[model samples]
Target: MLSILKDFLLNLFFILIPIFIVPIWIEEKNIPKHIKRHLLTVCFALVIILCMTIPVDADREFISDLRQIPLWLGSLYKGAATSMFLCLVTIGYRSLFGGTGFFVTVIISLFIMVIGIALEKKFLALSSKHRVLLATALCTFSGILSIVLAQTFHRIPLSSDISLAYLSVQPICMLITCSLKEMIYKNIALRKRIIRAEKMEAVSHLAASISHEIRNPLTAARGFMQLLEQHHLSPEKRKQYVRIAIEELDRAEAIITDYLTFAKPAPESIEKLNVKTEIERVIDLLRPLANMNSVEVKTTLAPFTIIGEREKFRQCLLNIMKNAIEAMPNGGVLQIYVSIEKQHVLIRITDTGIGMTKEQIERLGEPYFTTKGIKGTGLGMMVVYRIIESMNGTIHIKSEIHKGTEVSIYLPLSSNLHDLTNEEKKLFMAL
Candidate 1:
């Protein structure tokens, strides 16, 4: 009888040690909650080990003969139950915590397990830390109590068998729980990034709408102010005041025009067109402005096609080119390049002009963000941003104070274009 008791104790150790150690090692890097859940699962697995090995019908003569069943089979059953329980626990924890406080929860759980283990051993006569830890502790103590009662009363303990089975299977359950936690955290982070991008797009659209509505009236007002300047007036006295009024109106109109351009709706006439042609058109349009400032235009065009609205695309090029010309008031080379890659069209615009600081580049395309004073509406880059986004493209800007600036645009070769309705198409045709 002593030998049988020794063998049972040895079997318990062999079953429980790996179940505890393996999960701890596997989850070494995991945060506290994950570790806690995993540890709890290991404990719950101990119940399965207890049910499988403990002689359920020790009073029945035939049942004692069944001890020859392989010990490994019992271990495997314990592992499986632990795995299932861990999965359930992980799901529950994730729902409660939303993936935060993993480390904190794990530490608390470990403390609880330690305390629970000591209590179970003191009051309930369960041996081994594995039996008293996490979920396994509850099952192990309950099983032991049932076993003791059955022996004292000389009665069969049928319920104890089921409890023991569940107790042995904690390890497998914890592993499943940890995996679910990781998946939930990853999904939440991805969703946050998507929401941020959507907000940026909405801001760009609002800026564009405001600019468009205010521009035409501002231009007419400025034109009327210029006409008023032509009226006969006292040569010296009224001349200074009139000139100041005209200049102020001109500045206001320029600001309104810049805002309108930045907020203008993307033209619907997008088509597969040569990027080189677009760049050349922008250079030609900006030549008078550049020559007036003595800035030189240079080009290195590689044959590539991009599908986007012609007018909106033109505006993007024009804004960057105009900024470059204004930067090099004393004359500088404005280099434009168009190149093709496997799935994208790349446009690189570089200028040897007064450059901006890192902070300016970082804040580029933000609405009403500018460095050009009253001459800048801070909407140029914002407009460029909206057009590129509407075309499902990306823009990257790099600059260093007194060095120069380079803006690169990456446009996908195949864009998902929304076909215009009949009325929209007719409006485009009219324009």
Candidate 2:
């Protein structure tokens, strides 16, 4: 009797200690995922088998390894494939040792796995608290059902004390282990999320500080350059100097504003904005720059309207088109298309610039991340992302090496106007 309790404690320890260790291995991307799972599965089977042996009854004919914990856990956490693999190993290992009630263990383990897979979809849909409750309940059922199957099918008779131990100790250990494991893993994931948010906040603060320091000087320089243009000597020479000074100052000021937007966005003066009109204005504004690069601008605007501040909406278009134009430093085509779909307005901007790798696209909105050389501070796209998010829109970017890049922005249509049909009003706010 005392041996059974000691063995149960050992079994619980083996089951849980590895829960913490395996996550460490699996989370390390340096290790190939398949290798980690295979290694952990084999390790788990061995540990459970060893744990079951540690508490053999005094009769020496039977081993009371609380080993089923890993079988159920594998199915619940990993998937049907891994748990089934572990099940086969457990059955073969037990049979080799000619264990009593081996067939009973096999039957119960198979039943638990089938149920695990069937429940997996719904199980995952449950909240964390409910999942923990369900896991504990299922594990407890598995432990108890195994004992009943062994007694009924294998005709294994146990003393009342041993039966009580089987009913109480095994189920309780499973319950406690499941609860502890769930709580620990949840806390770890939550801690990671908190750390990521803090890092983004820190970066925003740094950008804000830099923008405040640079804006005044750039504005002063631009004003002085404008005054010098009035005292024209050679008209050509004056025009050239003024152009150079103004371009440099404008670029600097644009970057500064991006940083400011990243740090702290001003309160939006939300109103109905005409998307087609604003986009045409930006296209006209960028025509000079686009011509110098020999890039042709093609537009297919479908007159979509959305709810957002007009100036900010114009800025969004300006930043995107400017990037598209810059992408094609040598002659290429920039296509801007707008359409309505699924009660939403879709804007696609495609540039034949040197395209980006998958890794660069994934880091698109991260601070200081850019494919553009020193000419880009990487804040422009960050502001683009921020504004789109503020307006409840979604953005998707697709690109490949040498194939150019395509950016798609989707925004909900404004519901405020009476011209929109009853069904059409729901299109924008649906996001």
Candidate 3:
């Protein structure tokens, strides 16, 4: 019995290595849940086949023959059943009770596994996690039950066959369980992120509306004040009043412009354009600013075309580059790289400027979130984020304090213009 147990553990270990390790190491980024499930099933199936085919010798023929069956197979089935049950239970519990208790979940998992075994068919109704837990409970129960039956009967009627059946259910259950758990967690996280984004967008729109209404009158008032300053009045009084009016008008205008940029961003008129050409134009526009700060701008542009609003995209790139330039007022390298991967274009902007802390980066897309004092309104990156999102693109930022920052943008290849009604196109153009 000791030798059998040792062999069973060793076999189980070997079986799991392929199922877990290969997927993680070889296809790290895109490990599909279905592939994982099938892998578990195949691994356990092999173990069962081996057990039935292998020979064993001992005093108790039935026990010895049963020992020859692969333990991993039982483990797989139990795990799969338990996982499926757990998923179903979690969904129902979350809906009805708003949560699930750990112990209650386990109990439900065990019940589902047993039912699946008795039915001898994979229950597709339950989720992967519940299936896994059920499979685990079923296999464990079967193994213990087998031993009890043998001791009571004083013989093994079909110990080997029963053990093989148990083995088949466990591992599959475990695999399904793990997959379900991951899926659930991911979905929850995604939903939370989306909600936060929508809230930020709403705030930005409000800000923009207020800015627009305020700015029109402010512009007219400033023009009238300038006309008054030009009149032949006393030199000292004219200079002082003109200074106050001009300064206040400039300040008010700045506030309104920043607010509008954040709130009511214009939609992009997306077109297929060369990314390199766009970058060059922005570079020319920002060169004087970079020169003023004594910063060196470097670019390695790959020829890639993307369907996007050219002006809005330029503004996004300009905002990021301007931030980089400001960070290194003493001078540093602003490196830009444009590349293409399968079905997507990648833009990476790196700065050798003072980088931000983790906390700062985490709050980057939030409205009015800024590290630059007085001069910064904190809406530059927010605007950039809105533009990128509207284009159906993704952005990732990595930064280490004092080391520097890298921002990567991934845009899909589909440049096909979204179909728009004439009114919609006109509205978009006006914006």
Model 3 lDDT tens row, 214-330: 575577567657667575767786667677777657766655655655555555466876777888999999999999998898998855667778877888899898898898878
Candidate 3, overall lDDT? 0.61
lDDT of each prediction vs. the true structure?
Answer: 0.57, 0.76, 0.61
Model 1 residue 249 distance off true place after TM-score fit, in angstroms? 6.6
Error of 2 at 214 (Å): 4.4
Off by over 4 Å in 3: 1-268, 414-431
Q: What's the TM-score of each model vs. the native?
A: 0.47, 0.52, 0.45
TM-score, ranked from best to worst: 2, 1, 3
Q: Write the per-residue lDDT of candidate 1 for residues 196-283, one digit (tens) a residue.
A: 8997887677657556545644665566556566657556646665566666566566657666665556656768766778888888
Q: For candidate 2, lDDT tens digit of each residue in 138-206?
A: 877876777676677655565556667867887787777777768777877887799899988877776
Error of 1 at 190 (Å): 13
Angstrom error of the Cα, residue 119, model 1: value is 39
Candidate number that wins on TM-score, 2 or 3: 2
Model 3 TM-score, 2 decimals? 0.45
Provide the RMSD of all predictions against the true structure, rounded to 1 decimal.
15.5, 15.0, 13.9
Worst 10 residues of 3 by lDDT: 61-70
